[model samples]
Target chain A: MTMARRLRTKDLSAGYDSRVILKDISLEVPAGRITAIVGGNASGKSTLLRTLARILKPKGGSVLLDDNVIHDMPSNAVARIMGLLPQSPIAPEGITVADLVGRGRHPHHGLFSRWNAADDRAVTDALTATGIAGLAERDLDTLSGGQRQRAWIAMALAQQTDLLLLDEPTTFLDVAHQIDVLDLLVDMNLSRRTTVVMVLHDLNLAVRYADHLIAVAQGGIHCQGTPADVLTEATVKTVFGLDCRIVTDPVSGTSTMVPIGRHKSGSVGQEAQSRK
Target chain B: MTLIIDTQAAAPASHARNRGTRRAVIVLNMLGLCLVGLIALTLSCGQGCLPPAHVLAALTGADAGGADFVVNDLRLPRALMSLVVGLCFGLGGAAFQVMLRNPLASPDIIGISAGAGAAAVFAIVVLSLEGWAVSAVAVSAGLGIATLIWGLSSGRGAAGARLILVGIGVSAMLNSVTSYLLLDAPAWDRAEAMRWLTGSMNGAQLVQVWPVVAALAVFGGLLAVSARDLDLLRLGDDAARALGVRSDATRFRVTLAAVGLVAFATSAAGPVAFVAFLSGPIAARLTRGGRFILPAAGLIGAILVLAGDYAGQFMLPARLPVGVVTGAIGAPFLLLLIVKANRNGGTL
Candidate 1:
């Protein structure tokens, strides 16, 4: 396995033209671990991830990979060490799962080089690891939502990078499939020692699966630590701006935030308050 | 768990890829055969109607007497012009369509051809310019118009849709300028200017073929080098960038190459109507959106112009320009596409 590459942002400010979404922020992604960025809508979660992936140019400051400025480094060289799966990537019409995954070898080959055995091996390994080898010949348009997401993940896996970044990898899936994808990501992190960083919408899943959590709010990092340290009643209120009770998840033995809404059963709320 | 690096495990994926490659190869070979047959037929069946044998003998520099002048001087240039101009249009058109991720965003559909055509007409009718000067003006105007459309349509939401819409508007305005120039010109000049407007192969010369061929060599080579990066851009900007494609750089190279092709071809053959617009979708259908889209589209473009020019010259009641025949075919297809897009509520 390749050594896990260091990815960190030093006072990074990034956004679209003339609009700064993420203010001056400093953070480091732990190597060989899973880090999840969780935030409310338009809270700069994606901006942070994009800047880290070097998709969006930073307005100020820099993202450093292995002590070298990432944006200034040659893109292909950076891509050989790091891979990313953006939210809602468009698959060309009628593309097969294998062909899409094979495209991940782009960074490995020069302009005139042919696909070699190592590329085939990486693609094969990625397919097997993601459990999509059987669907290699299947058109992406024919796959189920969960299967399509897996195929996309398989593409990133085929890149053979030490660090992988994903933006909301489980956005539109059902609860079961969401867990399934998260489990697959965890499996990758464990088996390959690939540093995994992702933006996730589900707070409970982020707390359960991620080794480290970064809660973003109002364009900057509100808190960063292990899940146990980051998930709290006050943190939920501050980050998501919702009244919620932090409860111990029985299945995962992690902190789960259950939002307290006006229409909730009064008896249940009172029982939760009493327990607290 | 032990890692499985078995070569056998990759068989199914490689097999699928090989199948796609095989399909593309077979289709391209068939298109090549058709192009050969059309070129032969074109050389043989005009005016005095020489036999294939006589045409072949003339082509091979044998003494076929009168057939030599007819084949070598008359039909050869026209045939060669059709081939190169068609290729330029087809390759340029597909490049734009793929880059924009919209089938409706071809150079002719969007304003590049009109930009070139309008400039050529102005040079010929108003300035009384001839030859290279007209072509030079046309090429510069095409590039300028493409840049203008690109700049205007970029910013917030749905840049592809906005660009196509803006291009259509610009094309209309430029076309009207061409018509106005034609209307005010002297009668003799009007006929000459009409070739630029409707795209004629009427007076094609051997000298005219070389410039477009040279343009094809340079610009086509550029497109070929940038082909894979252009393919990745189909996945959208962010995803392509993540895959290490410098999206902006790739887009610039592709745009320059494609615009160069359109302008050069337009200068030579007057845009050739819908050859550029029609080639990509046809080739995509034939190749099933395979890896050889660019080359296959160029072949299809060549075939369209050759076949259309033949039909216009012989099969039709009146001797129409190649563009007229293709325009007749393309306009209805355009309507059908619009109807289909509307029915599906797709962003065409």
Candidate 2:
């Protein structure tokens, strides 16, 4: 792809039939950069992504891709420019990795065009991109969680879109796998300048990897900016409703958040000894 | 990057593998066709008393003495009915299985076939209707029942399991009504009602084949056109939509086509028990892959009906209806599936 396209929401309001989950949300996604959306449970982070991807119809307002209303564009046309990886997508029984990834080429072909060399190359490139080329013949059910996640990312990558939206892509993975996924996204951004938007729960990782961070709370954007500007202690308190200390990570030179709870005022052992 | 080079290098191997999978699918389909042909030949051989050479001669349009009427007139329509009805049921069943993402969600299990049966039996035993009137009512009733199930299951993105559970409950209730109508039926009408109840190919007319042919053409064409989207639906609604498959529209079209297929078949063949339920899993097992084998399943269904009728005619001491034999065979498989699904804890 050439220069990544811009995705923006204009006064967007959406929800499940008659109940609004996101309200009056207006934002512009920076082209060709990594952005992470962080929020508490049911904070409409995923819903926002779904609406922007045109999976859910917005009750009011619209999402735009390069000034065209995304909802108004043909779905396949939108798909050519943007791709989404949802939370916990199902794999059909007995599907091979190659077959599963090949489905991602669906939007590229016309109704009667058979799968040709180009489609095969795209699928293979996806498998190679995700480092699962050797496992192409393996069944999806047989892969480990991290490997499965990588395979799904490969499927999205096969679309070869300029923009990608992922919802909690690292939810079930171990710590190392989480970092592996983030690192892979960063690599894609650097190599292809693909615009990346993701919903993540790991605050420190978000700070380390995201060029822009969006904090959502109460059906609106609570904060949006670079991590250093958006991860301040006051903003964290407003967004998460938790008291927390913000410090710089010595290794990555990025902001890290340490939350304080009601029970622990100091070191636990010291507090117990003083009470005794 | 090296990823591009590695992908290019591995392309030929993966290309060969793709060809291999396609070959397996084609071979399985060819095998199904051969089985259907074999069963058709067996069905036309006339009580096993006629020699195969005589039957072959008759089939080749040569004069075969007295066996002409038995082979061409009586056996041909019934056997052709089995094939057509089987295709409808099999295609509809596999479509349901793929779209609903559940193996057990066949039209028969989900009450669409029963809806047609109930209406047809009611027309026969109570309203005193027959032929095309009965078929029309049956089709409408089947669509009505599918609509009802669709309504009940449409509760804010309820999953496939919910629709199936509701369908099982609804089918059980409709079956009771059918049984009651059979009991209260006049003695003369009881036999016809009973045939519809168990589902049979007995006395099927050559004229009756056209509706099913028409339905299969229209709906089968629709299915072929939407096969790619239907396959993408296996990834679930969100992912399918993300892939630009109009998920809701594709699902609606597939469901409509599937319901139309089974309804037309049921009106013609009296709901031929379990052909729809068995063909999808059987085809999947035969093909041994994840791709939807609509045509293969249709062929398997034809084989099942033809073979079932043959077994009913010759295997037992007293002749039985095709429906009875299929039911007898299918109930055991259904039981096996239930036991397996129970063991697997809700995968079915």
Which candidate ranks first by TM-score, i.e. highest? 1
Q: How does model 1 do on interface RMSD, in angstroms?
A: 1.8
Model 2 stretches astray by more than 4 angstroms: A263-276, B1-8, B16-20, B49-53, B124-132, B183-191, B343-348
lDDT of 2 by residue, B1-348 (tens): 999976666774266457647866786768666876755576456565676666667767898887777776778778888888988999999898888877778899989988988887788778998677877788789889988998998854344677888899888888887888888876845446656677777777789888788888998899888888988887988999999999888987888788888888888887788999999888777665456467778888888888888878778897877888888889999888878766763332
Candidate 1 stretches with Cα past 4 Å from truth are A267-276, B1-8, B156-158, B187-191, B344-348
Top-scoring candidate (lDDT): 1
Cα displacement (Å) at residue A207, model 2? 1.3
Cα lDDT tens digits for candidate 2, A129-209:
789887888878899999999999999998988999999999999999999999999988888899999999887788899
lDDT of 1 by residue, B98-124 (tens): 888777889999999999989887887
lDDT of 1 at A248: 93
Indicate the residue-level lDDT of A183 in model 1: 94
Clashes of each: 0, 0
Q: After superposition, how far is residue A6 of candidate 2 from its true place, in Å?
A: 1.8
Q: What shift in Å separates residue A206 of candidate 1 from its native position after superposition?
A: 0.4
Q: Rate the local accuracy (lDDT) of all candidates.
A: 0.88, 0.83
